[model samples]
Target: MKLTYGITDKLFVWFFIIVLIFFGTILVFYIDLQHIVKISANIVNKNNEISAASKKMIENLLSMEENEKKYRLLGKDDYLNYFDTARKDFEGQLKKIVQMEARGMAISDNWKNLYESYLNISPRLRDLKKAQPSKIPWIPVNVINEWIEKIYIARAENEYEVYLATTELNRRGQTSARNGLIGIGVSSMVGLLGIIFLAYTTLRPLRELLKGIRSISQDRFSEPIRIRSKDEFGELAGAFNEMSVRLKEEEQMRSDFVSMLSHEIRTPLTSIGESVNMIAEEVMGPVNDRQRKFLEIASSEIGRIGNLLNHLMQVSRLASSAIKIRPLSIGTSAFVSECIHGMAPAAEAKRIKIEAEIPPGIPNMMADPEHLKQVFINLLGNAVKFSPTKSKVKVLIEEDEAGTDLMFSISDKGPGIQEEEQSLIFNKYYQARRIRGHMDGVGLGLYISKHIVEAHGGTLWVESKIGQGSTFGFSLPTAGK
Candidate 1:
């Protein structure tokens, strides 16, 4: 089967493994504690049983001797029954003591053998008790005292062995419990360390992925992430880096396509425009009014197509950063007037007037002469196109006293740009929604104009409001001839 693990799945798998290890550690400690407790309980119970049996044997021996004295003094058979009963209880106690396994109790078996010898001498003593002190050769008092002393000694020895075994059992229990606690502590520490290491390894690549994702969100696709692990994160990083590369390539291809279309298509359109211009000028023959009107429409359509193609070419160049500005000194008065003259035909058709407020002694502007002409053409053309018939389009020029820069402005009296539209007007392909009438061409003119002004170390801006006149302008720094 093929293995498929994503980031979430991989992290979960690792976490489960760690948890299982912790549980396994706990289980080991639990099993050890159970064994220790059972053994300790057994040790305590056995010691108690052994001590009880020994104690019973000692008590019965004392009772039997006292009852035998009563029988010998009173010559009573009823007292002799008490001695017989004591003897039977002693035998039972000894049997119990012998059956127990004395694991740690040394001398327990020897003590039991010595206790059995007391039974053999018991029957002879019973016979002697009936015959009186003078009839028996040996004295009952000495023999009884000797046997009782031996029984006491054996009982004490058994009690001492039980005491030693119980003490050792307690010590072993404490030792086992202590070792279990230490094992638990060590295992927990190791588990915690392992979890920390695992988290670091897992989150490291995720952090890198976040960084790369943020970069893409901000439109940055230059660098690819490099991770050299064989885990799931490594695979994900490789995929993400591949996407970044593809995005970069696609952006390049887009620019190249635009650049190619603009260059490849401009040539034939230029030839067609030239041919139409010649025929319309009557170079071939004179034309009727109806034919003339058709020629005018064709000419205008050709001019519009040519303008669109020009804007597209400029856009491709600016997008790829291939445009280089060649700045030179130029007279603001002469340059501005020539740019205004080119738009005169359009202004004349709408009965719109151009007024220049040029002050003499204005410093020559440092700019790309061709680019500046285009900038003026865009600004002046927009002002005239938006102005109503018989309205004013004013061109203003000003200079700074430091001989550093000159400012050129065009103001039009028309349905002025709204507050929101002023900033967006310079963006590529943006047209104001509150436009007065039909507008020609794509929105590249103002955008192209803005770039050209900035390339010459100047700034372009607009000032306008709805229902008020609009003024669009730029500042140009002074430069050497």
Candidate 2:
């Protein structure tokens, strides 16, 4: 059976893993520390005690030798008593060392034997002096001194063993600390990787959902979000996809309705326009000046309705991909100059200066002249329409940085578009809130123009800020491409 992991499940698993790693690291550190502590205790309590006992034995042995020599030289019984006391202290310390060895100390048997031989030799020397009191010259003083040196060597060896044990204990402690740090570092790294993984898993779906939302907002409902996880985000994605499909169906129905309605209205609108023109021209009957003026207004309004129908038809065609591009090599400079001249009258009515900054030697582009002209006229018309009286509308033509496309920009000094509304402007039937009632358009010009430019492998974009101005720019591929 396949297991489905949700976002919460993944988070729980990662958290658990991190916790396990943390505790496991701590456990390892605890075990290692316990071992180090054990070694440390052994060195401090046992090894160090053995070393101290060896030192005391050496001190007592030296004192015994001094007292025995003094007893023979001064013939003093007090020196003999001092020698016996030192011997007893030395034996007591040796016994303590032996007991420690039996408990678990690691003193060598060879050292113990040497200590025993030294003790036996001391009693033997006392016996020899007692047996031959007048024969002091025959005393084994050199042998006693030799045994003293041997015991001193044994004590040094014991101290060296203690030093080795202490060094080993220190090594173990350092190793434990180093291993603990390594374990902690590994655990932390694992935790960090888990966090990164979890974030990626979570944010990937969110990003996809955001992209789908943006697509839907732009009226692009064809592409569905693809999130495969068994999480809440995945369920959301499924719902989002369903909504997109429904929205796409609804948009298609609306487009078809608009197209059919525009077609149904166009024939009567044309006939009405002709009739109004005929009445204004006194073809049916002679009319008064007021009647003629009203007829003229009717004619103008009829013409506007006709234009709106035409725009709606065009938008429908664009939606259905029915419009075809007839590409031709068009001269850039002359074409732009003509569009500028056509818009000059509109600019003059607004008292706006239309400035053209076309440099020489600009490359020609391959595009359908009629379609491209429509886009130019729409952009320039918007610039002239929205521009403040006496303000400047600048038309700029140039090549992009890559020199692969021709760039046209229409900048107007008008109440500019808001930043929030910029992206929505290219969407069909979407108008800026501020200009909804003030503007004359049904908001299809830029939408139609954007589609036209994009159809020719170009892009249309706007840069604007309130109270500053707006610049609508587009790029078309040059003839070389």
Candidate 3:
């Protein structure tokens, strides 16, 4: 069978398990305490019973002795026999009292000491009856009376002691029960609060994550994920934010690629259509050698579109592995000089002067050489296109305490980019709206150069102002020793 459960459900299940274990242990402690309380009550009751039996035995002995004296004074045989029978009965009761006193001894030490004193003095009173002295000193009777009095006093004392002990034990038991109940009550409240907090805290993030996932499923990459948590949920939110940024970039790239494709294809189609119209109207009269030049130019424009498409496809492949740096030590000055030399022909054609400044002690960089070269070439090419006739394009290289870097400043005397468009300049298909002159190629050159520079652990940014000039610069990291 297949089973499914949500994350919150699982958390609740574990929470219940923990609570169950905690309460179960408390319940066991409560049961054990109850048993102790019951044992204490039984001990107090047994001691009270021993005290009552001792009182009864003392009363019987006193009644039997009075009967013996009355029968002797009257000289009645039947009364004497009754006294003898009562004496025997009293002796059996005394033994019973002694056994009961022994039982009281087990309950508490005070009861045991009192019981032993009573047992020792009671035997002396029994000897007084056997002696039959002429003067009958009455001291024996007084002593017996004194022993009985003491036994009664001890019994009363024992009863009082047991009563006090029972009161305290009961009080202690009640206090223990109250405290345990209070503990359970407090623990229950705290557990309830903890469960509520756990549920609400976890559910909030889960709801946000669910909403974000649903929005992403609908291709809404622009929506921001709103999750604020300090735990793993915060990490998940960060991951989602990164994913949204990547998707947004991909959508922008797809849109730009489609727009560029239409523009490239239509430019060639328009020229081809114009050429066909001229040939059909006999405007060139059977297409002479000079007339064929127009056809050649139109065909070449179509071929140029094909070449641009091919180069763009290659560039797209290279951009797939964007920001994957392959670091290697490369001479800074030599690399910059080579880039300038390679693009010198184009610079010369535009009548743009090139200035190279490569200091003797400039260090190398750990970077992708080919990507760095592409970045310099793109910057130089832009300078060549925008610079006025006889204007200079400067390439400077220098090293500092921070790092060794080469700055290629391509300043143009032409009307520069607007302040607002500077940020969007690196964006694909985001051409400067204020750029007046017609420029060839889509705005992918600077964008591609920006990605390449960043991949080599560098930064690309333009310092430009309208109608003044634009100087684009990039920096790279120096190779570590």
Candidate 4:
């Protein structure tokens, strides 16, 4: 049965070819090395034997020349016997060289020819002892040494020939090995490219699938993913498209449910609050201390519920992109004063001082007055809530670094946020863990404020350390800048 692999397994298998190529190259080099070593040994042994025989021939010739001189000086037949023995040795060495020459070994032809000519003069040299010294044809040592010189010259030439041959052989070996390595490298490179191409055909579908998955995680349900193959990846793509359609439907249902519920709850909450107010004011009847306290608790809970409902409605509107901003030119100092005035009662209740460092004659900003005030109220409220009773909350208004936007920062001497939790604090329904004490919120305040600031083409961020107080700041573009 044929087996098919997943993209991962195919990748693993394809990459394994690289490792195999490396080992294959090593094996090829080793085979080449063995061939070279064998050839080198055979050539070296053959050349060494030829060189030794050539040297022995020259030595025997020199011995014969020496014995001839001794017979001339001492007038002894023993020298002639010694000279004959040396001649026999020279012939034996020459015979060996002739056999080697027949077998195509590199022996010098000049040395062999000279030895043959010297043999022709041998009958004359034997008759030298029989004649008187004057009749010996005045045999000079130069004549005898002349043949020895020829042998030496021939031996030197043969040694040079062997060196040149061995050097040529070594050069050829290196060239062969280099060419082989280059061939392997080129083939390996081509193979690697082929593997990459094969892997790409499989990985393309996976890349698209991963992108679609990321879009889904980001709540983008309308993004479509497609794969051409009828394999497993193509089927997964089909299933992914179906899931997107279902998720989009589910999101629509959720928005509809929230809108309907918010409207239904608001009317009863207003009526209940009015009724509680009348009871507390003795319009209906005089109330006892315990009854008044219960009324206060009921009133507080009703207000909390109203705030939560408002937050939910705003979130729905924001999600649906229904909120509109009617930006108007508003004075900076005036904006800050209005925000402070609105939150003055709450700050006073905690006895927390509100400090303002408004730069005089600050530039006006283009922003929705209500939304802008809401952003400040949310930030200032948090500051007031988190600050100690006697500590101060400072609001600083200045031109931003770019000089094109006015920056507003609310800093509090409250327990700061941790570094790791900084990024999560702006997320919807996310509240940081309080180190000093518990701070309460549904986590929607920062979320709403961030959107509001972003709607004005600005940004909101926080800077804090563990012990140092936190500064929450935002920048709004100046009017007409």
Q: Candidate 3: where is the Cα deviation over 4 Å?
A: 1-45, 73-141, 217-219, 222-239, 266-481
Clashes of each: 0, 0, 0, 0
Error of 2 at 357 (Å): 4.1
Residue ranges of candidate 2 with Cα displaced over 4 Å = 65-77, 101-157, 281-284, 331-334, 357-365, 399-404, 477-481
Best by lDDT: 2
Residue clash pairs of candidate 4: none
Q: What order do you get sorting by lDDT, best first? A: 2, 4, 1, 3
Give all TM-scores, in the order shown: 0.56, 0.82, 0.44, 0.74
Taking the tens digit of each residue's C-alpha lDDT, what string does model 4 give over 1-481?
Answer: 7665655665676667766776666676777667667557645755566578667766777777787778779968787777777776766766776667667665677667765766676667666557675576432467557766776777777677668667766876786678678768866795778677765765787788888876665334447787766557778889988998888787768767877898999999999999999999999989999999999999999999998888888877877888889999998898788889888899999999999998887889999998888899899999999888988999999997777999889999888899988877776667787732455678888888888999999999999987778999999999868
lDDT of 3 at 3: 53
Candidate 3 has which clashing residue pairs, if any? none
Higher-scoring candidate on lDDT, 2 or 3? 2
- Report lDDT per candidate: 0.76, 0.82, 0.67, 0.79
Task: List, residue by residue over 301-364, the lDDT tens digit for candidate 2.
Answer: 8888888988999999998989899899899989999998999898899899988998899999
lDDT of 3: 0.67
Best by TM-score: 2
Over the stretch 418-480, how does candidate 3's per-residue lDDT look in tens digits?
887787788654577765357776777787788778777678888888777788887777876
